[model samples]
Target: MDIGFASSYLRSLFLTSLFSFVAPLLLMGSTIAGLSIISYVPWLGRLSQPGFELVWAFLRTFGNGNALEGSLVIGSTCGLVGALFDTYIFYRQNTFRR
Candidate 1:
């Protein structure tokens, strides 16, 4: 009865939070790995590493937006989690009965 859909969607939200702590790492890794070979690259460098300076222009280029990056991920995932958790609570309750 679409209960499975609710369960799966909730599962996805759970996974989001469970893995969201790595958002900053993902950004730095993407820069290193040429900005993810799968996703869209910026207009500057299409298939190469972006040379944007993050914090210390003289030394570091990444890890500048670590907290900001994590915050963005947590905010987005929290919103999703709240919505899906509310919607799926009924299914979860019913599933427990069966």
Candidate 2:
């Protein structure tokens, strides 16, 4: 109930939400960017590399094998999973401290 406790709690919550949103979007964007860039810049493929290949393979197997579909699938799945994981970690930290 004290200011110190409230501030700390809010900080943790903010971090959890921020991380859940940012990390997945970054991953999804990067994956799509990697896929997009391969045609234009072949030599710089090192940046995305095998990770892009793996994701592309997944898209080919499960989805329509297009960039838009891949982006949607990757974004949604990564966001959901990342949110769950971040929430779990946040909950565990709060509970274990008590």
The per-model lDDT (C-alpha) reads 0.52, 0.67
For 1-98, candidate 2 gives per-residue lDDT tens digits of: 58997787667666665666567557767767767687467676675577677766776654576755665666566656766776687688879999
TM-scores, all models, native as reference: 0.26, 0.48
Give stretches of model 1 more than 4 Å off. Answer: 1-6, 18-20, 29-98
Best by lDDT: 2
lDDT per residue for candidate 1 within 1-95, as digits (tens), equals: 58987688678666665555455445545554453442354564543433433312322322244644544555565556655665587568778
